[model samples]
Target chain A: MSNEVQERKARIKDMVVSALEVEPEEVTETAMFVDDLGMDSLGAIDLLAALETGFGVEIDQAELPRLVNIDAVYEVVAEVAGWPLTASA
Target chain B: MNTTTLVRNPVITAWSAVSPFGIGRDAFADGLHAGRATKLALDKELWTGPDAEACLVPGFTAAGVLGKKGTRSMDRATGLAVATVGKMLDDQPRGREIATGDHAALVLGTTTGSAQSMMDFTRDSLTGEKPFFVDPSRFPNTVMNCAAGQCAIWHQLRGPNATVAGGRVAGLHALNYARRLLTSGRADTALCGAVEEYSAARSWLDRVGSGDDARVLGEGCAMVQLECGAEDPGRRALAEVRAVEFGVFTDDCGPALTACVRRALDRAGASAADVWAVSPSGTAGPGEEAALREVLGDLDAYRSPDLSLIGDTAGAASAMQITAVLAMAERDRGAAGRVALITAVDEGVVGCAVLGLA
Candidate 1:
């Protein structure tokens, strides 16, 4: 379970970094999509879509507001997928 | 230079439009007369729905015209361009009856030219190195200038042909270019306007990805026949382009647009008070509205926001706007109107034209 969580998180990070044209090292948990990565409204939508498709998780339009930073997005994906996620993992 | 001076006044002899609001000239005319809007249903499923409803061309096909072989090679944008020009020629007597040897030029404008083709090719190339079938013919159609080239080939317009891309200002630029060519004695007549075909692939991308942003799925072409001057005195000349001014307004468009309008009016030997009607860029924004009000003067200057029905056609928007003014020239004749100033501002570019009706 821990391994799965780590893998999924890593994949999401990779997708976000590539889609936003930012360095992988720059994608920290505290990184805000707009301020840190220079993601505009269009870029944010694209990033959200990528995260959903890459992780095979569904994100509701209403829940979009909860997805602010990298940590919140990961949490949402994990919660929706019924996976156990830990801070260490 | 003496060569740069305009020998003759360029006139829009004939014009045609194909859009979701209307399929042909008659349909477009009826729609315009009735004040009909062409906004479509935005379906999230197709990306033609809710978030962004665009004006799309209705019942478009390239069957009898291009044939199967030719159709297979061209993308949707090329298909629309070829089809629209065919209809324009067939409908307008002046456009169709022109002699084959007549030195007519072609200028086309577009933004997302061949993006659909590039997407398709990329998707296909992903499958295998030794692909099952790679159509080499589609490659040439993927070029940005393919629509202009194809139009030239179809019409046998062997003289100077060019294509321009300037986001929303493309059509105005093409018209201005045609005006320059005719004035400079490069060609007697030219087919100038914009062509764009919304691809299914583009829609698919938008549906799955492009969120919250407003973009309509639309495809069509609008073209006009421009000649040096009226061929016959009896013919009711729609409008004569007296002067055209272009300005790059990167920041505040108000002052620059005002200056350009002043320059255009000055060149046309007219003043703001002489101008009765104003056709704006009409992008459904406040900045342009403020600029128009400030530059043209008077809150009620016969403004037409027809672009709302046609969508932001980029290049076609300007030509279509001018066409509207020309269409009204016949009606405004009784009032003894001297000129109509058409203004188009896009991104950081401003295009203003003063037209004389006879």
Candidate 2:
């Protein structure tokens, strides 16, 4: 994996933990929001907003279905922001 | 009377309404008597001129109605639900579950459920860095059933409780459900009504229409206590639920609404002549107005005079119209001898309720 992807992943992890008030360990790349963190509808909304502003991407209501996990969210943000993943940032 | 007959005639023992006018029965009574319109002139500063005017409940604070602990976990919908229930329960001595032992279910109706919270979430998600920063306590309050759930929890009601949304017909639908519960002996007394919380999104939709959104933006909560049989003691037993009919009509509002009303009356074992008055779904939509004029205009007994004053209250509109019908019944006991038809339609969905004087 590229360093840019790794860095963005770390930042996303931190944002999720801080916004949801969950432990850092609770927010792994594979951790599902509803199943792993018990994030309800409000939590989902908050997390989406945080990701949008932090990564400078727009997540419309139609795109909600695609944003189920950390990787999916990161990919969308990175792709939209034109942040190509590299071995080093 | 047999259980079938008794259950068929459920009575409203107590009721309460909180609206733009103010709190309690007297305020509404005064407002109605003086024909005071609670609608506020649209605030140009807050919103554009077209969307400015709305009937908003003034001086409403969740803190005042639902104490600190209660308000902390509640959304605006639940807050209004609990407030209206509190007022209704206060009027009756048997509301105490400890005293009654039996459970009291609450059935609340609304067209736009948690839409306000959703709008807030949209704004925050679109602007904020981390969406998860949203308050944890506000999570449960975002559901459509939040208001009903909170009311059940506060009142300690363990029986069936639900929140229904069907545009203008929601209030009557809630009462209809309450009636079924009472008749089936599922609950002895049910707190039933409808509430609508106007939000920015709703306002925008109102403007998007051909500038004639019949459905007005109204924020308020109103509840009526339903009990089985005439033995119940309240003087304002605002008519009994005889029959409730729900349907959807794409076009031709005339035949559709008339058929629904006819079905309700047929189920109630009443006729047009038996109906003293008609509380048509007064959304003030051009389509509905024309349809109602055609339907009720032919009937000399079916008259409506409240929609002009109350405006359209959405989910709470049916209850508001029902309240007006009940008030009429209180004044003219003879009207009670006849059935009153309360009908509401929105977005092509039509709901009709037949209320006979209890």
Candidate 3:
């Protein structure tokens, strides 16, 4: 991944932390939104809105279920914002 | 035949309070004895137009008392109820044992749920970018029984859970309900109380509504543990609930209040002279006071209208007043075996409870 994608990923993590009121260290790339991070359906919507506002990107409603973890969230944002993905993915 | 009969009264095993006096029963007692006003200026963000004051529980963070988990979405009313219940349970010798049992019940009283959350959720649904994008977590706080329901869930109480809404008499209603449950052998032990939280919507409503001019708004929760018994030797009994009576009036509260007190005293088999203290509802003005004076007639009792200091806590007012009476009984050895009368006048209803200190 490019440095810009890494920076964006970091920013997205921060947004999740703020939205969920969780510690930065507690939120990991593999942490499940609902199971591990304690984000209920409402919290998930709150996170989606926060991410959209912070990144200035519009996420499709159909993509909501795809946002299961931090990595999945990053992928959706990357796809929507047209960020370049690594060939290894 | 006279209806008065000899019967075992429910004992108040433990009690706790969260008021502007601060968190616990001791703080509440100290604040009352200190005789200083507990009212503080309402937050500018909450009250944008006029400078209003309320008795808000200071530095109360539910996360601090109850931990961070399962509290992020809790409103102030629910938080106060939970925190007060937690404190009451802590005072019990086998609090954990009682809470984990299936026979322990919870009955909480509130004028309503968090008005702020209700308004905010409704406003969000109307003005949000998408019509259906309202926050889902706040939906639970909008319910009238949210506080009682949350208390049961958080404490793992699996028994009967009920929420009573009786405006200013909510505390008496909760206590009366719990007493009935205990008497009927439906529950082994019960936690009963009332809670009120200060909010922008509530403050605005009070200003516009037909509330008493003398009483200011306040917020807090007061809870007591009740069990079917005549004072147990092993347990610390604060007071014995002899009887509870309530009645509705069309115009004059004076006669209604007098009748309620007379009924309570009669059921308790006690006379007006037996009462050591009287904690009438803070909202009770000249008419109610005159009724109390007429019924009791020059009775030497400590008349502590806590509303003058802590303000009117709405649904929680009666519970807080009873708590004050209990504190006085606990502190004063002279008050032992002396009855205490707590009266609540709200809307068109008058409720009275006679408690005898053990």
Question: Highest lDDT among the candidates is held by which one?
Answer: 3
Q: Is the docking of candidate 3 incorrect, acceptable, medium or high quality?
A: acceptable
What fraction of the native alpha-carbon contacts across the interface, defined at 8 angstroms, is recovered by model 2? 0.05
TM-score chain B for all models.
0.86, 0.87, 0.94
Looking at model 1 chain B, which ten-residue stretch has the lowest summed lDDT?
Answer: B128-137
Per residue, candidate 2 scores C-alpha lDDT tens digits across B159-210 of 7787888777889789888888888888877888988765566677656853
TM-score of each: 0.71, 0.73, 0.89
By summed lDDT, which 10 consecutive residues of candidate 3 chain B come out lowest? B1-10
- Residue A33 lDDT, candidate 3, scale 0-100: 79
Mind giving the per-residue lDDT tens digits that candidate 3 earns over A1-89?
67876787789888788668788998887888788888876777778877776676788878889888777888888798887764433
Better of 2 and 3 by TM-score: 3
Every model's Cα RMSD, please? 16.5, 9.0, 3.3
For candidate 2, the TM-score is 0.73
Candidate 1 backbone overlaps, count: 6
Q: Deviation in angstroms for B304 in model 3?
A: 2.9
| Deviation (Å) of B174 in candidate 2 | 1.4
* lDDT values for all models: 0.69, 0.71, 0.82
